[model samples]
Target chain A: MTKELLEGNFAMAEAAVRAGCEAYFGYPITPQTEILEWMSHRMPELKRTFLQAESEVAAINMVYGAACTGTRVMSSSSSPGVSLMMEGLSYIAGTEVPVVLIDVVRGGPGLGNIAPAQSDYNQLNHGGGHGDYHQIVLAPASVQEAIDMTVLAFELAEKYRNIVVVMADGSVGQMMEPAELPEMRPVTRIQGDWPVTGNVGRPPRVLTSIYIDPPAEEVYNHKILNKWYDIQANEIRYKEYYLDDADFVVVGFGTAGRIALTSVRAARAEGIKVGLLRPITTSPFPFSQLDELSKRAQGMLVVEMNTGQMLDDVRLAAKGRLPVEFYGRPGGMMPFPDDILGEIRRLAHTPLTTEGDPRKRWMDRVRTGELMLR
Target chain B: MQTEIVFAGFGGQGALFAGQIMAFTGMDAGLAVTWMPSYGPEMRGGTANCQVIISDEEIGSPLTRTPLAAVIMNLPSLDKFEDRIAPGGVMIVNSSLVNRQPTRTDVDWLMIPAQEIAESLGNRRLLNMVMLGALLQKLPVISIEALEKGLDVHLPERHRKFLKPNIEAIRQGAAFARGELTVEATPGANGHEPEVIPPTSV
Candidate 1:
């Protein structure tokens, strides 16, 4: 319908509304308070339900309860808050309930400052709560993407039959940009046909993330793995900005990519053909895209607000074929454009460290075009 | 070309709403626009601000430390943002709310006694409309007709009838600009100064 300049967090809420989110239960957190506020205001207008959940734990349990009823449910919090919801997250994944959780990352092992951090990467992508299950994690770099990804999370969560977490940093939650509000069309209701809720249907559906025996466990894990593989195949998304002709590239996602985008423009002004590879989907990691660009880019620099979560992932994916360096400011301090430019400048003069490190074997294969998305 | 602006002031003033009008007006004029308010803890009874960016091309960043112009509802915002404004940028201020004068002569500054002008109009709630008028005076950002249309579009149906006084408030506010207007023109709208009109009678 109409386009509004919505904040990233509000865009997430609007996207949820567009995706036919039946109910919302969340607490207020920095960079993400707007979602709670927006949903509170908007839901009533549309005759939907929104609750100010008592605590992160209560909120997530509420989401689990709603998802058990097969409703499109959502819960959002920052890193520390997400930690509290891990028990529920594990339950949601274990029960194989289709739901969406948003972790707007902020600095932290604790009550880290309200700044954005990507440290939750390992936690989210690798099963933060516990178990062998992985949440379909989608990272959005801009407000517009926040809307799109939140809507997509519903589709992916249902397709893969798992919890989909839209992970972002403070900057992503805070940035404001021109976003097209979805036409105020009604969302068709979602029904999980696994037959879990009742016997009234044609067949009974038992939804559970449990394995009864070795063969069953193998089968279950195999099934989960297959779904993941398909996600990798069909949904690995990223953007290539000025990368076709470039000497160096900056790899980042969420807010880090946004700050770096402005710098990339400046770096271009200085006659440095530095491009950007922004991951629109962080979980499927978009390794294949980075691998392809490595052939053309002389080198690459991975920038993140965390110490090295995404950087390690990039290094692992790049296989050292290109000189991959990183600059990080963990715990709530966002990297300014100048810091990014400095990293770009430093990488320009340094030679690729292709040998003798911990990842030497991996890099060896990467340089010879042998590294892959294993 | 596109223009970006921010109107900052203490909470309870018209800064956020003023920014909203400017943005909606731009949108009504068919320009791509974004109006974002300060989110989180900062928007309490503390300072509140809204950012409005109107661009013919797609706008990249929504939060900018620098803007093509600014409308400062008070002194702190002026102190906080004046140095960063584009050198030749325009500034519209509520002189009565701010106690200090700007030291820079490079940029254009319109020191309108906005709150006073609003009070002189029959209601103090028109504080934002005055700032809106002053903003319109400085930049051809939105046509007067477009702004009135925008307010009509955004205000609730019950409030739409208040448009005339709001327009008058904005007009008087625009005229309150130091050189752009004379103080007498605003204070003379009714039988007396709107600043002393008293809320109950309005």
Candidate 2:
């Protein structure tokens, strides 16, 4: 595949098409509006289904209708719009319908500004919808990763019969970068006994969340819970940088993680033993990995674009084994590499150097036995 | 080496498109690139800007506070981004709309009458291409050929007719910056006298 400069939203639409997505339903929302706009043209040209619903609520239900037929369906929106679809997502989760939802999150408790933000961490990852159901959340750091993850989201949704959410920020949606588009997966007909296709020759299949019998509902809840356990055990995804030997580990996810990774490398160049742990799968949360990193690193510095929402999860993953400190810039503000580097230096007790070659400083420190790389 | 750039101007001045072209050129040349625009209500009728990073290695953070270069097309953008360029960096100014020159001493500065040149060419929408041409002359971050191909990729079929004029505007701007052409005093679009200022390079 040839690499092209593609905006993240357009890349997502292309990825979904390549993944054999049959239908797309979404409402226009900033940062994510292009996904629908691009699909509005691409889907029809490919002879697939595309519709722009009047509202986010209508959009997700339309997705629900498409998913009932066992077809690949998707919808996307920003933060506030994601809130509007919570009920539909919950219903979809309860009915065990496979669908992909994309949340290009923006700052918000209300109708926030349309800049990039990770504030929806809690809303999307912590089961925003009702009931005890969970949605598989994937956070991508780069344009290419966003494409790969969107493709993966569809497969995961169908495999588990769950709602898979690709939670990116406005940065990922609006930013343009070079990425290789995946080859189109050969179109395959959806032939399953579960779909509500015609019931003339076979028994009818009904998909619904309502159960009058409490015991039956309880059993269904247990079934979903057991499936979640299987997912938790098998689907924890993350990326580690310079963690083989490090004294400090900076934990971030999504765009924050990408920035922290940049800062960690900068800090390493400045003779500070720093590393980054990025959780690619926010739902599974990479608990055991963090636990293992905590055992070796001195402490963890968790960073986010929100007001410390993911901090609680990092703390839980740390298991009280290490000091998990929080550094955040909320309300649609992104932390720069220098700011994160300062935090890493402060946490590691390393002297900050803004002048001279950082490599030479590290060499001098090593020569005098004043500091160790690990 | 990595080059961080910010293209700034008013909402409809095509600053974002300039940055997008830079990103696309880098991608066409097989260099890693990222283009991040200031996207919000401000983009509707206010100032618009976008940061572009072109690197030989994989880019870490797509945002840069201090850019290595900047293309300021209007007065407000000049005020907002003048002090943000890195020391010893380069700043390409569109001298046609901006009457003020930067006072910074620690950077390379080039002032081109991009809007006037585009106006003379009969299409003000080519102003960004003209500014881009001046920027490429100063930085040469990507080849002019790559930039042409990039423009081809971005402009849809409906807009293909403007491709020739846009490329011609870019070439003329580059030629003016390269000292291949000289400016002449001409009447401004509003019947006011425009100055025949030589391209400033320092």
Candidate 3:
């Protein structure tokens, strides 16, 4: 396939279409409105389902309903809109239906400005909705990665009968780059026995989240937990750079991770032995891999677009074996490569320790306006 | 092996489209490219800009703090982006709209009357193409042939009639940068006399 200049949102929408997505339900929001806009015409042209629901809440429930029929269904929105979908997402999880979601995250606790951010790390990875359910989360840093991951999200969602989210920052959704889209596949509906397909040839099937019996609900909860275990065991993925003989390592995911790569390369050029580890799957995070990196590296730095949301997970993975430093830009701000490079230089020169909270130390530097110095 | 360029102007001046053309040309030439626009609650006449990065290696960050080149289409764009160019960078200024000289002495400058050239070419909207031509002539980041091909592939069908004039505008702007064409001294649309800043090389 020839490469085309594609925006991330439009590419993901087209990739979903080619991946046999039969229905799409979404509302419009900045930095991600193109996805919904593209689907509005493309889905209908293909004789597939596309609905511009009254609100994000209604859109997510539409996704839930479509997923119940074992059809490839998806909905995309930014941070606040995704928040509205949380209730519906929890319902889908409880029902154990396969669904895909694209969350082009923007900054905010509420009604934040529209800009690139990774603040939803905990919201998506740590189970935003109630219950002991886990959603498989894939974070892509580039337009090409976004396309590939959108196709993979459908496969992963169905493989585990769980919700799979392709989480990206507003940058990935808004940026344009050259990428080859996948060939169109004919829409195929799942013919599995689990789907509620009219129940004509067998006993009537009931698919609902209502396990009123406490013991039975506990048993179902255990099943969901066990499936998460399988996902964790089989789905951890990450990308590594310059880690073969490094003395220090930097960890980040999504946009933050790619920006750190620029700093890692700069640090390497200056003869500093620094490397980068970018996690692709944020939910099934590469915990064991970080443990191995901890044994070899003297110190670690965790970079993010939020205020140390993923740092806690990195700390758990490092297991206090080495010092961990932190740096972040919260509330719709993105860090330049030079900013991350400054943090790398500090990590190289300063003495290492895990004695204090890394976030506190970072906050102290931020308070003094030291991080802003060139 | 890498060049970061910023296109800045008002919201309706095609700054984003100009940057998109550069990105498309770079990609068609088999280089890694990224184009990111300054998106927000922008009105039609408000400031707008976009950054384009072309690299031989994988791009880490799409946005750049220091651009290697810039196309300043309006006075506000010049005021906002003049100091952000990297040392030894190239800047193509639209002399028709901007009346002052750039304060920086370390970077090269090509002052072309982009609005005048576009007007002579029969469309004021070709101002971006003119400035883009000047940049291509100065920096040679991508070939003019590749740029033409990009337009052929990416230009919307509704505006296909302007393809020839757009190409001509680009050529005229390149000629102006090459010192083959001269812009007459005339008052700008804002009633301020246009400045004739000569092309400078550091």
Candidate 4:
């Protein structure tokens, strides 16, 4: 086990190389530019394909084109750049191409700043493109998990013949940590009958998404939905900390989830039965787990860097059996551990107050020196 | 055990590099480590800072709001980060540039003429290594020998010749920090006395 210190972007690039990814197509965007920068030299030196596309749209199309040949291809971008790639991603999903896409999230709406945020949760989990399709979204909180999930993204993409998305915040992309990289796998071009081959041995295979017949389109939609159902049943991943016996459960994902663990620990030190549930896969979200855990908790708090984007899912998972509360710091801001602890204390002690802004409550406590962990 | 440190200075002063070296040394020693810099397209001469966290267990967050130690190379960095150090924490300030004394009396402050010592050694770029040596003297989070090995891996091949000088500068720094090598006050040294406080266990 060789351990080396690596940043998030470099780790993802190394994982892609180790996974025998054949091609990379991407455009430069803040927080995610390092992924493209690292691959620019590595892919060439490894004798693999790499391209710096003119724009994110062109990059996703390049990924689509490479995937059509049954090659392992990937592209990455931040919020604005990802927004531009939705069209091509929709086309790729409609065509059922197995491609990997990474979104190093930043504050969004339009061309947001290069700071970490979970604002892209909606765009990634819910289909951003116009189609009845879903991308398998995996969210990693740490650099090590980033490397592990990135390698898994390729295998899952290949297994389901669908696009896979690795959703990470800018914090994970920028931070450096000691990571145990997976060993390199032998590069082998996938020779399958599904992809279009230039006429040497088999019949022509046309990979298209346009279904002129309504009945055929409906059948295709059902096929895709069945695949999604299978993924939900078999691919849902999550980690539970101190939830064996807890009256309050805190739910989050990605960076927000990682920070919540600190708050949960501090709350536990104070004898509060507060636990954490971090969802690893956001699309085939661990709804069943959340539903089961909800029955054992007094209430649930959904923390995020966005304005409650993932709260709806938690509510649906609870099915009105438990009260769901949300606390968020939107616009690329992050809440400290003490901030979440204060909220946990408030929620565990009293009902949701309707006094001042819930978002500003923690900041106000900090001003008065009341926001403390212990 | 866990230690949170902030390295701050001008962009060209290599605070980021020092932080990376600390993180690398911690990782090589089989400790969990994280290094984060003040990123976003800033060129040389602008303010720069990097946060490093070394712990024996998994780290929850990479960013540190209150650092247990700080290495400040310039006056601006000191003025900005001096008070952010935790109570009973330690700080190493480059006495060659900073003139004012720290206002916080609760922390231990080590004033080392790192840049001057490096210049006297015929290389001004080894200032960060000198500061690193002094840091090791105070905390010994990682050994100097391990740091030397880290340089072997982290230093660029073209600049490998400076490894010896860098190690020498670090030794001089450790000596000055230990009061084995006394430094006379130069211009801008402000005749500030180096304050030493017993190390606090984290």
Candidate 5:
């Protein structure tokens, strides 16, 4: 149980291997290439499958094929690379096969720079592919969490026969910290009558996403929806800090959340009663918790590394019961703790309102060149 | 207590490695630590930097806008991070490369000719270790013994041959910082054999 200094990408890759990931197929992408590099050697050493496909599209399709065998399989990519795998992901979702994906998100819209960002929050949390489907998104704020979440992703993906996306920004993927990895588990394949392993002694079982009959597709979609409800009820995960006797709350996920914790602590030192709610599971987000907090707290500040994508979720969860303010840095820029602390100071002193759009208010501040001073 | 330090230099100057060594040393001393590097399409000559935070409590942000200390190894880094160090903090500058004097008067500035010291030790790459040695002298968040132990545990096997020289470079830098040795009076300059230090205990 000795802890060693481990980069987030390498730690998550090793965690997947220890979690008995039977196959890995991925294309090289910045801030996450280390995962593929680690898997290329470790997978072969364990006699597991590791293939670097020509592109992310091919890699995800390979993941789809391997996942159908009822074995643990995954792929890792940055923002643009993950975008290329959307069609394959939708197909996998339709076919009801479990797959673990790690999105080490970078700046995006298209061909963006490879720097830390939470811009992919909307793409990963809300369905990236064209479908009425939801992927279980786990947002890790630190290296240790990245390792733990990777292992949990495999378990969750298999448990519900759904996709689990370990959504981490480039900062988490590129940083290093002391973390103890999990013990290696023996590779176990599903023993059920679901795998397409040649069907030696029984009738051939077929798996495909193509449902020509409209009613049959509707039935399958309903089944997926019901499963999502079960996930929503059971898998909502988050972390809280200094919520007791607080007047205001800050809600963020992944790196943004951790950064806000520093700001929250500073604000507390300044005699401001503030706390933080950091979501670990962004899909089955802690909406109920936010609702409960909104009832008690005076107002909420939503922080992010993107232009208020998760802010939408926070507003929905708050139900406009209290005023919600927004602060964020778009593209590849990360918000320093001081920047967030400034926002928290404003939230503490100003008279908040729920009437205007929080994003618009934030935009006004940005347009006035107020944030540049920090 | 918490200490945030920035290691800023050109890409090949080993700033990232020095920060990693500090992080490992802190972690070995049972403190929570994080090392975050500024990564992108930067090449060997491009600017590179990393922030290392060592704290008794769980760390919130791995980065800082105002570091408690900074190890500046080049002019550009000094230009970029000079004012970022908090008042009354420590700034270790590699005087061998940076020619200008620091404008700030609030922080303690230790200008060590790290490149000259490393070259005297027969390897220019040891400049990072030299600067780190100076940092430990001024701000002993972790002891020099622990740093030596960190070198033992974290230094790759391929670079093991330079261990003795690296340690010597660190000691020389520390001695210079402590005012016991001057930049013009390093060991090799006085025809004295460099002392052979004992191996670190595991």
Candidate 6:
């Protein structure tokens, strides 16, 4: 059974239904409130727990409680609210509790407006909560992807016994489109793997992000790097749209990826060879495929809603092999598809002989850790 | 491909519903849509607004700095959004609520006394629907037929009977349109039309 018309938030709730998560706990925030609202409305019918916590702080803890009980559980919020949940998330990461967190990112810095912005790329990619850790973050571009990624998020989180985050933005949370609902299972799986349930028959488990002081910095770095590397090898996913024959590859994620796909289609119609390399999982950055495509393409255009955040990743993946260009809008500006096509054309035709602009060069050096923030 | 608009006014004035119906109507037309309402202490008698986007393609930013159009159900709405409409956009004001007209000459202004219209219709609850009607007339992206079809789809199963008059309102609004705005076909492969429908001028 499938429904043709559904809202993005509703679609995510539907994904939650399919995943059979035990609880849906969250606080309301712009662009993201719909998910909580939908769950609240639909939970009763499904006989699931839907609690609107007092604050994001309480909401994340509720998810932690449910997850600790060894049940599939999830929570979500926008940027500010997610920031509040980071402390709890770090704890979840430490204990390796399998819970999914959806960050429907909006603009940032302070109490930024409720609009879609990918400014949190660094936050989720680097594990914004605190301590030495990282969260599995998946970026979804369209409404359908938001739902699809949601099911995959739960699967990955449970498989690794870790925290999985479906990082989206206001656009993904608020948009409505036609989506085919996936099927539901007949068997009600017993969710009893929680770390803190302390059930009589199972061994008692503890969940915490606390780690005593490690003896050396290198030890911690190596330990974390191993996990990140594992994620990189096993989880890296990038979508290539008409990339088999292309002069340029537009690298983007989330909403930008959708726009880039549209651009690729338009460029193909005009006889210009262009394709898009969409990063499905941002934290587990897909560098291998990008490395392979770098030899074939003349240049790479990295588009983002942030200023040169992903451009750094593009450079890392390409290793200075291809000329890289960046086109971005900060705070809350979404680039038009025409602008994306224009960038692709300009970057594809332009030569790579130049060392790029002085400021851009300086910024790249600053970004690469050759320089530090004052 | 998407035009995000915000309709704002007092809580009971049907401001949020105006944007919601537009979203629902757009969805019925096979266009992606989103509706968001502002909720807080300030939202009571203070101010209220709903953000809505009607799009033929995938919507990127759910929020907009400048909406393609705005409907000010009260003085605070106009005062807050009069300067925020995009260049050559439209601002439809409820004359019954706001005495002051649009101070800016950049956006097309429509002064519809919605309270009076609702009174004539024997129900003030229809203010939002009346504003919706005017918007459906002025903004031709989604057809009158589409809006009617959307109301029937969105108005709940048991109360779906209300869709008849709502559909009639749309037709009336369509008949009231003064200028000629042809129905724009879906944009070609470009996904964006450089100049599809004639730009609405102030």
TM-score of each: 0.83, 0.90, 0.96, 0.92, 0.96, 0.74
Which parts of model 2 are misplaced by more than 4 Å? Answer: A189-193, A350-374, B145-156, B159-164, B184-202
Q: DockQ for the candidate 5 complex?
A: 0.76
Q: Can you write out model 1's per-residue Cα lDDT over A146-195, one digit (the tens) per residue?
A: 88889889888877778899998776787555578665556455665652
lDDT of 6 by residue, A1-374 (tens): 64355667778887887877778889998878888888897776788888999999999988887777677789989899989998888777766678898888888778987777899898888758777777788998777788888999988887767788898977777655556677774324335554565558877665555556666545654676677667767887767788888888889998888867767777788888888888999878887888888888888888888776877777888887778877776686677666677777777665653356423753575579553332
Clash count, candidate 1: 6
Model 3 C-alpha lDDT per residue in residues B1-202, reported as the tens digit of each score: 7899999877767788899989988998899999998887663447788999999999988987889999998798899999989999999988877877799999999778888888888887898999998899999988887898888887888888979998998899899999999887356454374333322110
Model 1 Cα lDDT, one tens digit per residue, B90-176: 888777667667777988887777766776777777877888787787787777778878887776567777788888987777676
| Residue B25 of model 1, lDDT score | 73
lDDT of 4 by residue, A1-374 (tens): 68888899989988999999989999998898889999999999999999998999999999999899989899999999999999999999999989999999998778778889999898899869998999999999999999999999999999999999999989999989899899999887667778775768767789998999999999999999999999988999988888988999999999999889878988999999989999999889899899998788888889999987788898889887777777787788877777788789987998754334444554566458675422
What residue runs in model 6 are displaced by over 4 Å at the alpha carbon?
Answer: A2-6, A28-31, A39-47, A50-59, A130-132, A183-231, A242-244, A260-272, A337-342, A348-374, B1-118, B124-143, B157-161, B178-202
Q: Decide which is better by TM-score, 1 or 6.
A: 1
- TM-score of model number 6: 0.74
- Tens digit of per-residue lDDT, candidate 2, span A146-229: 999999999899888999999999999988898989999976546666778778978888989997899999999999999999
How would you encode candidate 5's per-residue C-alpha lDDT over A55-118 as one tens digit per residue?
9999999999998999899999999999999999999999999999999999978998899999
- Tens digit of lDDT per residue, candidate 4, span B1-202? 6799999887767788889889988898889898977775452347778899999987776765678899998788899888789898989999877887788898888988887798899977788889989988887888988998988887777778988998898899889889999775476456453232222110
DockQ of each: 0.19, 0.68, 0.73, 0.55, 0.76, 0.16
Candidate 2: Cα lDDT at A261: 77
Error of 5 at B145 (Å): 1.2
In angstroms, how far off is A343's CA in candidate 3? 0.5
Best-to-worst DockQ order: 5, 3, 2, 4, 1, 6
Angstrom error of the Cα, residue A251, model 1: value is 2.5
Q: What is the C-alpha lDDT of each candidate?
A: 0.76, 0.85, 0.90, 0.86, 0.91, 0.73
Kindly report which residue pairs in candidate 4 clash with one another.
none
Q: Which stretches of candidate 5 lie over 4 Å from their true place?
A: B185-202
